[model samples]
Target chain A: MRTARNIGYILGLPVLLVLVWWLSTLGSVNFFVPKPADLVETFGEVWFGDRFFSDVLPSLGRLVVGVAVAILIGVVGGVLIGSVRWLRALLEPTLEFFRAIPPPVLVPVLMLLMGITDSMKVMVIISGCVWPVLLNTIEGVRAVDPVLSDSAHTYGISGWARVRYLVLPSASPQIMAGVRQSLSLGLILMVISEMFASSSGLGFTIVQFQRSFAIPEMWSGIVVLGLLGVAMSFIFQWAERNILRWYHGQKEVENAA
Target chain B: MSPGTLAAGGAAPPKERQRRKAGKGAAKQLLGILGIIGFLATWELIPRLGLIDERFLPPASEVIAALVVDFGLTAFWVAVGETMKAWFLGLLMAVAAAVLLGFIIGSSDFLRKATNSTIEFLRPIPSVALIPLAVLLFGVKIESSLLLIVYASFWQVLIQVLYGVADVDMVANNTAKTYGLGRMARIRYVVFPTALPYLMTGVRLAAAVALVLAITAELVIGSPGLGREIALAQSGGAISGMYALVLATGLIGVLINMLMRQIEKRILGWHSSIRSEVIV
Candidate 1:
């Protein structure tokens, strides 16, 4: 019964949003704010077959590689710092300083230092995505009760064994949270780097299409990107729930389902 | 006091001296500065030695010169001003909207639950990806940039605000209710104050996002902004000029961050995070 009411409530904004979008784009509205119908038409036409897949596929490939590399680096580095208090103290300020510097702004520097290759794009994305995961991992590890550590010690569970059994399990939820944060950041960097300077990828495809006044195609690229973003996030969330089922505080989100 | 008398203070002296120990601290600070300088010096040396292409990767000296000479150009500052205006305005709008909407959405359990999925869906879409759509609709105008900034900043701030609002202690609210406070009064005195810390976090995040979007929008559409200047420099193959603009942008980021930190510290003096945290 409540489900119907919730559905109605959720549908209200999108419905009104579409109506207003349609009305504004009627005759005198801005060309930029195209109607929902027009957008649908454009979506159908440009996002149909090879044109859609070809443009989007490369960007997705880059995002996957870049994000995967970032996770590996971030998680490893985080564990190192988290397990050792001295290392954490030594590195935390430096990491915070770098994190404060905007990642997109590094395009010029990266291009100069590394060239505008796949490496540059991947490196830039890694730079942005690494911080959240690393920081969160530190926090996650820190949050584990020392009593648990002492208990593990008493059992003679030492070194990596202790970390794997006690720290990792307890920190899994927070680490996953960090991963979720990094995923979006990675995508943003991917698109922005491509948009900033590239000859291919969805970002480059959109910019090139726009330069030639291919408005519908440009719009199609954006919609695809948006949908891709939505899809990836959903996938990550589902994966998190599956992997971190022991997480105790997510009842509210599960209740929604 | 004599040296022996000074030593008689015992524990405090040793503890204070240990805290102020310059031995490792001096070396660490020296290493950090040396690392940056070493990096730049190597880059400059590499290009000078013809090991790297100067056209693509100019020497540090050349970049500094370009920055000095070109800093006076009208186009440069005009672009900076335009981007700053959009960024500032968008940040203000985002803060206002996120605060209001976040409060509304977070205050009710039903709305929060229903909207959680929707928020998650919107969260992942990179705002930069919306540039093409924005340009198509707004036509390389200021509105396009502003809209992009708002879009990028909004979700970040909104999420932060939501978390902030959620963090408000229920026990405190129940206490307020027990004292017979009404909904509005309870909200004004209890909810808003508790949420302020979170709101500040959101605003800081939004500021960062706003800067990114503002610059990125200019880059995409050739709009007047620092990013546009950098783009122009890059395409013109003025490598030094590009470096200079990059440095300028970095400096701007540093300045913005420092300014915001001061403001946050002053305004949120009572907050534990600001007061208790140390850099190390």
Candidate 2:
């Protein structure tokens, strides 16, 4: 009985919500909200069919490549500036100013510079996604334990060796946190860039569907985007867990206190 | 906004540059100043140097000139006001709804359980994905922006508020219960204070998110704002004007971040995070 009630608590509202939606849109509201059944059918149709290669794959490719580039640049640059005091101060304000510019605005500027190309879209993603990673990296790297660094220094571990052994591991948690933040930003930007200046991609397809009044198809596009977000988050979390296994272990031990 | 609280949280490593200002070598300080000047010069000279087309890559001086001229135009101020109007209203509504729902849902185990799977499902849906839906419902009006902004920022605050309400001290709550405090009174005297810090952090984050959605919505939906202006200028081949509008939005972003930090400092003064802000 207790287990049944717990199950009810977990599933109750969501089931109720779907029921209400289905009931309300049974006939009349179908024009506005297309039925749940229709949505699922369309979801399968678009995602599993030819639209997969034309729309979905290109968007995913740009997103993955953009985020990967951002992470690489952000981590390396962040470490350089973060470890060196003067470099951070000199560059900090400039970085902040650039980060302050909304990522979408850069789309127009990038279009002017590079035209409506994949490189432009990728650039928009990079500018938008890079900051959080960069800022967090700097914060994470700088926040590394001074005692450990000082020990390394005293032990004659200098320059590259000191950073490789002493710094990166300590800063990994914060760096991962930054990456998590950027993943969502990257998704937002991926759609925006396509919407603003592209011929294809998930965002353009959604707009195209809407413009043609293909309401069901538009809804399907949104569903695909949602699944993409969920997938990215799942992958990120798994990577984060594995990457920071020791950190989590220590955290659990601390929590037990 | 991501950096605002993180920078202020005092968990940051020492900003040795500020600390050693006087005792620091003069050469290092000079290089820093030179770096910024060199960057500005490069911006001014990049197109003038003929590396890029002048028509497309107008010099920094031209952009600055456009910015100065825009200051003299009523349209620029009106655009700024409209953008801020949407941002503040969306942020206010999201906060109100999130706090009310967070409290109601968080305090009840059944409600919390019931909503858990649904929130997880809904939270990660990028707000940009809703642009087409928003336009379909509201057309190219301010309402489109409001819908996207509220939906996106709502999750930020709601999640934080949920965490905050959950963080209510068990001992403090038990003490209230022993004193025969009623449910509302317990929430007021115990839960509210514990949750205020989390709420502020959420608001800081949502402010930035709200601005982002507002701009994106305007840019795509063709609403009246700086974003729309930027799009117009870019398409019309008003390159300097587009850059100026972009710069304007950047200034607004910086201002919003600074304002949020100020508000957080004032409100969270008694909190440990704010307490340590003095040393930084």
Candidate 3:
């Protein structure tokens, strides 16, 4: 009963929002922003049609490939620099410097050099996503309690074993947080890159629809993208909770203590 | 929490700490300088050796020369001035609106709970994706760019403020209330100051996002800015010119970030994260 009440409470806000959306567009208001029902119909058309799968698949493929590559590179590089005090000192500022430069600023030059290809889009996503993961991994490594390290050292665990057994688990939660952030950033850049060029993808579809003044279709694209963002975030949160149950349990223990 | 506790935490031997300190000092300085030198040398030597196309990869010397020579150009300065104007204006509005809204939502538990899902739903929608809508409404103008910047920045800062306020220590709030403080007074004296670190972090994050959106607006709209300059230089076949501008823009971004950090440190000197030595 309590769970049902909580679920109802959770669902209440979106219902209110949808109601508002319906009310606002019932009269002859701004026509550009289509009604919620219209958007739903358009969404149905796209989802049931071939146009949706082709666009979504390529975008999802790019997103998975881009984020995976970024994670591998960022984690490896971050671990190296972070574990070695000397390397961390040397590379930290440079990393921070590039991290600050708006990734989109690099997009035009990338287009010039690479010319609107899959490789260029992948490169953009990698560069954008890598920084947060790398920085967070470094912070996570640094944040490991020295007492734990000392305890491990007492047991003669050093080198790779130390990292795998002690450091990695300790840092996993923070690193996952960074990965979540990177995923969102990668998604943003993926769409932007496509919006800048591509002949397909949801972003391209939106642009194409907007250009043709297919307002309903354009609204549908925007609504779908927004929903995709929310859905992916929910998925990531669920994964995090599942994978980091230990971390959550630890928190509960700390609170009890 | 106490001085005695903190002193006990630092109970490691001085000699070992001294050695670590010296090692850290040397490494930090060496790496920082080495990083700049390595990048400069790569830029200078790589193109000069004809490995990459000179036109596309312009040597460091030529890039530096462009910065110096083109510094006086009306067009370049205009672009910089215009972009900065939009960024600052949009950032100001975002900060103001976000703080106001954040305060309202943060203060009321029921309302905050009611709106929580709505906020979360809107927050994840990449502000950049709204570019089509923005263009449709306002055309390719500064107004559209500024609106997007404000939109993006508001979500970030508002959320930060919300979390910051929510995370305020319960004991601290109760103590203030025990002193007979009213709602506004309690908030002003206790909540805002406690949230300063979070607020600063939000501003810092917003700064980076604002720069991205500002450049993106220029890229998409073909307006005048560093992004426009790069686009123009690329399209005009002035590859070297494009490279030079890109380097300059990168340097400018670095400088802004460093400056913001410096200011954050100065203003929040009492914050442990700013004043205390790093853990590693």
| TM-score top scorer | 2
Worst window of 10 by summed lDDT in candidate 1 chain B: B271-280
Residue pairs with backbone atoms closer than 3 Å in model 3 (clashes): A90-B31
DockQ, cand. 2: 0.58
lDDT of 3 by residue, A1-257 (tens): 98886676678888987898899889955769788877788889975689767898788788889899999888888778788887787778778777777777666667766778888888888888998889989888888899998999999999999988888888888789889878878877888888877888877888888888888888788777787888888888898999899999999999889
Q: Write the per-residue lDDT of candidate 1 for residues B54-146, one digit (tens) a residue.
A: 877788889888889877888778877898898899899888988899999999987887677668767777787777767767877888888
Using lDDT as the yardstick, the better of models 1 and 2 is 2
CA RMSD of each candidate after superposition:
5.9, 4.8, 3.1
lDDT of 3 by residue, B1-280 (tens): 7544664578676558779889978878888889877877887998899987776677888878877776878888888887888788888899899888888888888768877878888988777678778778888778888977898888889999998888788998999999999999988988898888888888888887787788777777655587778778878988767777776667777877887788788888887887564333
Off by over 4 Å in 3: A1-5, B1-27, B272-280
CA shift of B276, model 1, Å: 4.5
Clashes of each: 1, 0, 1
Ranked by DockQ from best down, the candidates are 3, 2, 1
RMSD in Å for model 2: 4.8
DockQ of candidate 1 relative to the true structure: 0.35
lDDT of 2: 0.89
Each model's TM-score, in the order given?
0.80, 0.93, 0.91
lDDT score of residue B196 within candidate 3: 83
The 0-to-1 C-alpha lDDT of every candidate, in the order given, reads 0.79, 0.89, 0.81
The DockQ-derived docking category for candidate 1 is acceptable
> What local lDDT does model 1 show for residue B199?
80
